[model samples]
Target: MTPPDLSVYRLVFRLGDALIRSGASSATTTKALLAVCTRAGLKHPSVSVTLGQLMVSDQPDDGSPPRTRFHEIEPGALDIRWRTRAEEITEHYLLGDVGLEEALEEIEDQVNQKPSHQWWKLVVGYGVLGTGFGLILGGQPLTAIGGALTSMVISFIFRILGHLGAPGIFGYAAGGFVAVLAATALNTAFSLDQVAVCIVAAIAARLAGIASYGAVQDAITGWYISATGRMMEVATSTAGLVAGVAAGIGAVRLLWGPSVQLIETVEADTTHWTASILGAMFVAAGFTLASGGWAVRLLALTGLGGATELVYLFLLEVGTTPFLSITVSTAITGAACVLISRPINLSSNAIMMVSLMPLFPGMLIYQGLLGSLFGLEDSGATLLEALITAFCLSVGGVLGQYLFSEGLWLARRRQFHHTHPGESFSKVMPEEYNSRDIMLPVFSKPFNGSEARPAGRTPKGRPTADA
Candidate 1:
């Protein structure tokens, strides 16, 4: 095997880096990188994805010093435009239609792609997100209106922070703190019954899904370092959010007459199914706007949101616990993403990720943290339950992917290699190859639903199967 041209190596590096910074999971990014290189007919191209950097190299079979290239990556900010364009560039290259200059131009275009909607439009979308969450949780009219107001405040803070180019951690923390402060004030001013739902909704659009699906995939594939880094990023962002909310609530109590009650907002079984589905749609559309995704994708995600929430409701009706209900709900969503995304030219990463917005434990984090601080009854238990719920989500996502998509991914790789000799598989492709890879003897083919490989991985990050 000969070394790839230095320009091709550089293009590959840029492509992988763009995917990472655009919030593609380690597995998806890695797989996409390998696919592009293989299609480009590069020999023994090597790529390593770390927390803050991406490295790609071309190694000759002769064993001389390999030429390598790298890029420093800021933590990802979800922009579906980047991922979509990257996929196009890769597929175009694979079809043998793109030249080096075209690939470079594509990368440049992606890096500079602006949001599909205006800034003010995003603010309104976030407001809709808060309103949706409030309705889903059965908030009263006052609570729903207050939630929208609070979301606007949070959006304003984020915009200012973004304009100033502030550090991500501080910006997130500030948004959380301000959102709580706004909600509490609104609750007092309106003489509302409970502010918990309002506050949760205000920040619903901001809760970052744990890239745990990516962590699961990385750990499964023996990339422990990258896995740890990915998990830590999620933890740190969540901590910032918790601290900000805690501080904001504490400050309000100190300055005001009384402490804000840490009410556990619970909806009765009679909470309307239609309301849940509609609210889920609102949340999904809001997320797409806030994150700079295209309008067409939003239509699909909105429908998916409704369908998945119905699944969650069905599980609850069948007497499922909260943890189990969430797991099953996520599993259904994961399966839908796997079956639906490819034909539509959508990135599964974005769809599975935003689908989690309706189910994430945003309010629970605030209630648990404040409850413990105030020495409220069962506060400690609430906190413990919150942690358990999070663990369940991560586990569910991993299981969903394994059950739905991993086998198909493996089978596809096997078949591709069998048909086209001398092409290296993605790094996610296991080292050991057997007849199962070529024929999928162990699992069903894509969209077949014939084989049950037990519960699987992937909720958001790589849909648990890359998991």
Candidate 2:
């Protein structure tokens, strides 16, 4: 067999780096990289992915030496635009619509694509994001507005720190610290209730919801090394945020003494349904704009966020526990995104990551941290509850993906069997291939639930019985 040229390794490295930096999971990155290699005619290529780096290696079949390359992924915010373009190029390359050289150029173009929106627009989006979260967390109108201003300030701090090359954890810590100080000052001057609500909402973007979900999903998929790395990220990020908020609170207590009054905010009641829905949409839209995505894409995320919250609020009113309600809502949202993202030309991961922000435990984490700091007896329980909620969010997302992928596999198999009549299932899909393997190429195919080519179909459009 003729061996693939060295460009194959470069292709894998570039693609994997983009995906990882764009917040794709290690397993997903590895899968996409391998698919690229296979399509490029590289046999038995090995790809390894971690939180910060990727490694790819392959040997030539005609008695040539093996070549290995490694790439360090740069830290980047979640940008649906980048991921969407990458996926589109991959799909086109896989479908033979583009050659190797063209795909390589496309990858470089995406990596170098300038942000369409101005930096100030992103700051404005952050403000909107915080306001939405404040409303969702039951803050009053004034408090929600305070959250918006606080979040805008925090976004400024983050950008400045990034420009100065500070560590990411420190960025979170600084944002948290600023959030508390600003919220407290606003609350004191205006008598806005629910100070903590404002603070949490302002710093909601700092919460590790995506990392937590990725960690659990990686662990479930047996990528222990990547899972451990992601878990560590979640731990450090949350710890920094909690520590910053704690310090701000301590400083306030020391300065104001008895004059500083802090009160706990309760969850949103059913009467606040309008505010909650609006808040969710705000968060979704704000996230998209903040991430430098196209304004048109906000429609999908906003709709998804609003619908998910509507369902969640309804479930809560029906007497479901917060844990059960959030899990079910996240799962349903995940499945819905998977089903709809392809048709709309959006990234499912992007929608899932942003739409579920309202359900994240940012406020809970802050409340628990405050409780522990004040030496409240229920502090530990509150923190534990937050932990459980984060875990449930992860589980729900992973479960939703599996349910959708597997259900589609079954439906496709049944359709093929009905049409073929005499062919065995093993002819196309073997026992070794599971739903995950089929779904890993998500960037390459659409999940429209229609009659389409089987996942394992041959290049010539003929059904292949082999594994």
Candidate 3:
């Protein structure tokens, strides 16, 4: 194998380091490396990447070059080293020969480029999720449909905001709140069902949390470099959603007063095949819109989410305890996300945000707020339940990631053994290959063309080398 060019290797290394710091997954980092190598026109770039492995090749070997290989380490095993490398890359890439301003401008330009046609998928995803939310909240068909529509429109608006460089978290939160308010107002004005309105609003709010880059878990793990900037962009676009919903709700409350009843529970017959198909379509549409342009992928994701919800509903029908059902369902969804995300390039954040929307305790928050406003005693209980639900969701996500990472490590270990039966896998370097044994090659001129002088030495009292 030919030695890689040092300069090009360094460039790739730097970018990889940055990606690592930004909290990218091994798969994402590997893809980014491959992309950089491709952009640099490297030969056989695909073969050069081993997911989660950090290889430093200062100069290539004359014999068969050290092949890229995979080894699994505990998450955060090389965090410090990776962070330093990332910082170096960031410094050189953004602030070296090219001015920082120029580097930033270039980054912005890259971000603005439409890499895929996935916008329709996002619209559908958001819409479908909204419809499901309506069903869960016991909304009527029209209210559910209206809520889904409202959510889709808000999602499109946020996409535009994202293109304009809005922060993601704020954008999502704001979007969600606004969608809720809007749905609430429309339902109230037309004597529509509150259940349906709330469901749609919830779906719209959750869509704000979707991200194409697949960095959701990274954000939770303090992989801020990777997660922070992107999340901020999402937050900003979502703000509009929250604002719109809040406005609608505020307007409704002002006209109707706090005493108005939103939903009356009539014993309606359970929906069957037709209703299920319609519900599924709504979910698919919501996810499609939320996914931006990745409609096919979004459809698959919605199906998964819908299946999860259906299973939970089934368990409920069988008289399984609500708490147990929720716990089991949450675990299943979280684990499924961990297992399937990498193969398809979807981010766990998008999955978690959308899949969990049906269970986010929005009703609790609303009821709590209403109780507090009206000086009701049950407000405290509602607030506590809401907090606990959020906690459970967060905990479920973390547990899923940890389990997945460990599973990857085990799989890699098995592969390594199968490939090299006699070789012992050592986490530490062999004595001969340790950093201390590696010597810096000397570059010096010969003394009078007889013998080369060592670097940093001279015949005279004065030193030949600067330090």
Candidate 4:
């Protein structure tokens, strides 16, 4: 039988890369691929895959003649094929597993082949995410609109930077800092609510760093790939945010006296239920539009955010410190995330971003900065508190993730024991596939009254099945 087309294999590889990057479970990724294949009118497209077996070829180029080969298939049987040059195979063995840099290079090569307009899809998606963030931060409608627009523009600029082969970290930081500074200045000059404007800016900036899928997958499978990427992304974005805020504040300090307060005090709203619900809806709409997510999914995410905020408000009303409130709320959010793992396709990064926004201690940070500009002695204490609050937020989020994952593991063990009576889970749980044995068949082919044939080889001196 003719081997499956190379284009199909390429498509699978691309989809797999995206699924893996997005932190989707293998089972979910497989199911989604099946659905896509079905939609595309493909036949017998169901394929079994072992994780890590689908790695990008890392063989080096050497001056030699290229080689290509085809595999054979029995009538009505599946055909699998692979291609490699001898030099590439040698290099692949020499290099061992390919690193992220190599993987990204491969991805870039493939992406470059597609129409340029495809990049806009990513921009639009991130823009929506930013807008949702703005609405959640209690920005006005216009602020949300502006933030989304600005995020899209920045995304395009970042794309250009990428095309120019700029360092990703520098590009992301520069883009994010510029966006935030611009938004902050616009808000301050026009007497717009700086807190709301900051929220919108922060959301836009933070979207550029969101890593929900990676964090979740890392938490689930003990993989560091997702975890490290997430940490780096968060750290860089935070640096950008700090830099932007500093720049904007510095400009204000220079023009006005250092003693002038950039922020004006406003009365806190006492009405809760109506405003909260409306705000939640606004957040939902913004996110739905930004992420290109389903309305139901957006609503669910908004509900979660609103509910968490209400809990924090309650804790605050009872004299809880902002630090403690954020800590507890984040822990709760993390626990919920672990419990509702599959249903909440929302990334932990995304959820964490939204949940933390309302209680970000931005006001405290601003106050501390203001005090510092005026050289207030007590400013040291305020700044310390501000730093502590930020520390607590990070700690709470990490603690939540750890506790929830551990709890899930324990629960799974308990369930296993309950089902197996005296049996231990260690014995019952299947061992993870090792790289050496992943492609080895799990079941022997059914006896066909013929000797087993090597993959892609036709039995010699026998009547061909096709004949």
The whole-model C-alpha lDDT of candidate 3 against the native structure comes to: 0.47
lDDT of 1 by residue, 179-218 (tens): 7788888988999856778878887556655365556556
**Residue range 160-265, candidate 3, lDDT tens digits:** 8678876545555556555655666666667764643453345434532333133444455444454554445444443443344445556556866765443222
Q: Which candidate leads the pack in TM-score?
A: 2
The regions of model 4 sitting more than 4 angstroms off are 1-153, 180-232, 244-292, 344-387, 394-411, 418-423, 427-467
Clashes of each: 16, 1, 67, 1
**How well is each residue in 266-374 modelled by candidate 4, as lDDT tens digits?**
2223245445434444443444334334455556666666676677667777898777987887678656644443354343434454444444444445445545655
Better of 3 and 4 by TM-score: 3
Query: 1 or 3: which has the higher lDDT?
Result: 1
Q: How far is candidate 1 from the true structure (C-alpha RMSD, Å)?
A: 7.9
Full-model lDDT for every candidate: 0.66, 0.71, 0.47, 0.45
Is candidate 1 or 3 superior in TM-score? 1
TM-score of 3: 0.56
Model 4 per-residue lDDT at 233: 53
Q: Which ranges in model 3 have alpha carbons more than 4 Å from their true place? A: 1-112, 115-124, 156-181, 188-190, 199-204, 207-247, 255-281, 293-296, 317-320, 338-354, 366-377, 397-401, 421-467
lDDT of 4 at 313: 67
State how far residue 185 of model 1 sits from its true place (Å): 2.6
Model 2, residue 310: what's the lDDT?
Answer: 97
Among all windows of ten consecutive residues in candidate 2, which has the lowest summed lDDT? 443-452
